[model samples]
Target: MLQDYTIKKQPTKTSKLIASIEFILVLLAIQGVLLLFNQEVPTSEVAQFRILANSNTAEDQRIKQEVQKKIAPLLDQAISQSTTQQQLHDRLQHLEPTIEQLAGEYANGSAVTFEHKAALIPPKRIGFAIQQQDVYDAYILKIGKGKGDNWWCALFPKVCYPEEATVTETEEEPVKFFVWEWIKSWFS
Candidate 1:
């Protein structure tokens, strides 16, 4: 009996194209899921207080610090006592004059203005939580030109200082995705 040999046919162009498209689709799906996972969710409903400095000079920076020091205690007290956003807003509004006076005194009579608005704040580490870039209801205390770096803290939740804030174990742990891990294992 003669020995038989078999020749395997090469994949067709269409089949190759389909395979490439399928691979791309899988990649896109994975990317989409990862993007979704990376999305940041606010851990708590809280308001932010941001104080912008007039300039980056030593004097301006010192003034900003002084203003923050004066306002921190008052903010902490008001925020701790308030329960809702409205209450916090009302409290901040009530304290606007006092805050302005403090800022003005430290900033050499620099015009101080208070603005309440939804602002896009960048990623920040507030006490124990890392906040992502998102729009938040903020009480902005603009000093003088309002053209310098800002100091921000969670005013409503009273997480301004690390020592004063409490962090749970779950909050400190990083987010895990078992499904993503399995998918990665398959690729590996």
Candidate 2:
């Protein structure tokens, strides 16, 4: 007498459940890694512009406003033409004498200084995005004492102006599968 035998392997219910759980954990880990990398993208590449008033007095405030008005158009023109941070810096440098002249006209002959440097800026809302407190390359126009309230805005992105500026909301990138949606699909 002779006999033939064959073997077949099938996954049990428990094994299938374990495999699904493992797959979900792996997906979640990958999502976390992607989020981490996304967060690491640099935000310090932008340039800023600031105007510091001489004092908080009514007259000084008026002078600051005047100076801002006179320089706003110049800044807008220069910023609009610039395509890079370095170009912005160079344009500001070239315009320093003109800026000082404009400030002196409104500042009653008070000395004004134009400086480009890295400075710690406070948190502020620029257009749509809220800029966090951090060090940034800034073009500062210091008037006389430079001890009063300051006006600031982004220069490289060209979002700053004396008037109210609006930023169109950008659409977010769509994710392939959200965690909640993935979980629901797995159970169903």
Computed on alpha carbons, the lDDT of every model, listed in order, comes to 0.76, 0.77
Q: Give the worst 10-residue stretch by lDDT in candidate 2.
A: 155-164
> Residue-wise lDDT of candidate 2 within 7-115, one digit each (tens)?
7878676676787789879989998876565433245777778888888788988988899999999999989999988888888889999999999888887889988
After superposition, candidate 1 runs with Cα above 4 Å error: 1-44, 150-188
Task: Write one digit per residue (lDDT tens) for candidate 1, span 41-91.
Answer: 563477878888898788887888899999999899989989887888899
TM-score against truth, every candidate = 0.57, 0.57
**C-alpha-based local distance difference test score of model 2:** 0.77
Model 2 clashes, total count: 0
Q: On a 0 to 100 scale, what is the lDDT of residue 33 in model 1?
A: 75
Task: Report how far residue 54 has shifted in candidate 2, in Å.
Answer: 1.0
